[model samples]
Target: MPWIRSHITALLATLLVATYAAATEPPLSLRAVTAENNEPFNIVFNGKLQGLGVDVANEAARRSGFSLQTEALPWARALETARQKPDVLLFTVARTPEREDWFHWIGPIAKREVWLWRLRTRKDVMATSLDQAKQYRVGTSHNDAATEYLLAQGFEQGLNLDITMHDRAIGYKLLASRVDLVPMNPLSIGAFARESGIPLEDLEPQMLLISSGGYYLALNRLSKAETVAKLNAALVEMKADGSLQRLLEKWQPKGSKARSPSSPP
Candidate 1:
């Protein structure tokens, strides 16, 4: 009877230690980079960083008992942070074949359609094919996945493509007829145009470029798998509970509606 009591006492001690260890462990700490003015997804307004992506990341952190730290930076530098820092997260990134291996991905946060847009005034700006479109000047960003996609398609910089760091720059250059066309996502094209003070109607979608993928929250590939797994599980629950859907609906730009389920491409 004494031996049996001792065995039970040891088993109870083991369970208590395990529970204490789990509770005392530090929560996962994450670094996230947000594009400075990529509205509706990530934006700083009234000096506060806010957007659908912002809300999603914060909610995931809370659900997983993780701590989230975010910084607003230019897209170029943000790309560097996501690539180089494990545990750092990037959002609204297109999950393309070229980017599938870059990060541990979560959520098709938004549906996206990349388009070649040109001014309605320029009748010569239209191109029926990407190759034909390549014959005209196109504004793209350096190290951007879209730029990489175009380059892989045989577009050469300077010869027919002009690369820049600012998304708004492309829109402005196109308005001045500096670049004949620029790639834009339908979800944010109007915002970009409006940011540049260009009337939305002045821009017309010409060639519908890549539209097969949507944006995702990506953790650096070197991130701890267990931590990433917890965050992803939380995100999956959000999606199933329609929390993710509601976030999209809440942040959708005026005039355009959020898709019932975001369409790929």
Candidate 2:
């Protein structure tokens, strides 16, 4: 009877240990969403999602002991879904004052400069200052932070602001002279021109909007604090180890050298 009692106590101790481990373990699966049509950052190629943001996030999730699944959506819809759903992840989002409190901020995986763009041939259109830029119609996408900055500077819809849901359409409108200016990254010049069926030399940066703005991965506000902490730690380790920099170099655009992962091109 004494030996039987000892065996029962040992079995109960084993069960408690297993239960405690399960309760304390972090979740091993995650869902993330990104904006479509953003090449080299969050684009789909050959039916698979692969880009700088995708690659960086996948590596970070692996280091954090999690598996990540990603979906590509329209920019505004992706922003909305990540905000509304608990634990959802969004990546490569510009860190702006307007968006600072929307989610738990993660690493600034990439940095890019935004500028007002125009046709290279349009020498007559001058945007020497923000006020001068306001005199001309500017193309913008829905819920874009750069657009928000312009609005804060007094650009009004249907007046100087030409708004659209498809980001590529803004480039097309700029090509056709429907809008005098549009916000763009110089790095995207070749890709956008190709997508718009124009020559790469057609577009040029008119005026700088955001100089080296940081873009980060964000998790929903409802995510567990531990989840945020794990991801944050993983990104920090990756940066420190130079693995993040090497990964960015692997995806660097053709004909251009890669810059530091934390620095803008």
Candidate 3:
């Protein structure tokens, strides 16, 4: 009996020591980037990065025991950075067919649709189809998924597509009648308009461009496979435990529905 009791005490002490060691370990640090002025998703407000995309990325990193440092850059630069740099993460990216293999995707964090928006006052601008839309000048962010899609459809820059470095510029261009149309998400219209000091009622949806696939946290393909797996597992856990849904609800405006379940594109 005495020998059995001594063995049990030793095992307990070993377990405690192991737990303490694990608790004292520091998290791995990671670098992440997103497009500048992507309101409600990847916003840089008051010199701080905090938005739905930021919140989701931060939570996923925390759950995976990684410390993430996020930076906001022009859309094109962010995409290029994530493409060429090893171990970098990009968030709020659409997982289009053209981009499926560009990175190791971690999530379908939020759903969104891309539409062609025009000024209500511009009664002369009308686009009922992609071809009809092509006849009019449309503004887009540089290297954005919408821009890539449009280009693939035979849209040429400096012809019908007016590309800007910042996503915020698209809204302003449309308001000023500089561009007859702009591709954007309807959900972000209010926030985007507010950023440009324009009324949401001024812009009207003309045509829907992209409605499939969702936003994801894209990790550089050159990153460690184990790290990608850990971040993905964290997102899966968040989905299963309703934390992802809660986060969505917290960020989404009232009366909006949240979709937390979906397969990766």
For model 2 the local lDDT of residue 196 reads 73
Best by TM-score: 3
lDDT of 3 by residue, 1-265 (tens): 9999999999999999999999998988999999876767887778888888888899999999999988898777898999998789898898998998889988899886888878888999889899999899989877788899999999999999999977568767777778898887755767767776777667677777888888899988889998899999999999999989888777774422122112232
Candidate 1, residues 115-197, lDDT tens digits: the string is: 78788899987697987897899998777777988988999998999998777788788878889998877767767877878
Q: Candidates ranked by TM-score, best first?
A: 3, 2, 1
* Candidate with more favorable, higher TM-score: 2 or 3: 3
Model with the higher lDDT, candidate 1 or 3: 3
Weakest 10 consecutive residues of candidate 3 by summed lDDT: 256-265
Error of 2 at 114 (Å): 0.4
TM-score of every candidate relative to the true structure? 0.84, 0.85, 0.87
Preferred candidate (TM-score higher): 1 or 3: 3
lDDT of 3 at 187: 55
* Residue 143, candidate 1: C-alpha displacement in angstroms: 2.5
lDDT of each: 0.82, 0.82, 0.83
Question: What's the CA RMSD for each of the models?
Answer: 3.8, 4.1, 4.3
Worst 10 residues of 1 by lDDT: 256-265
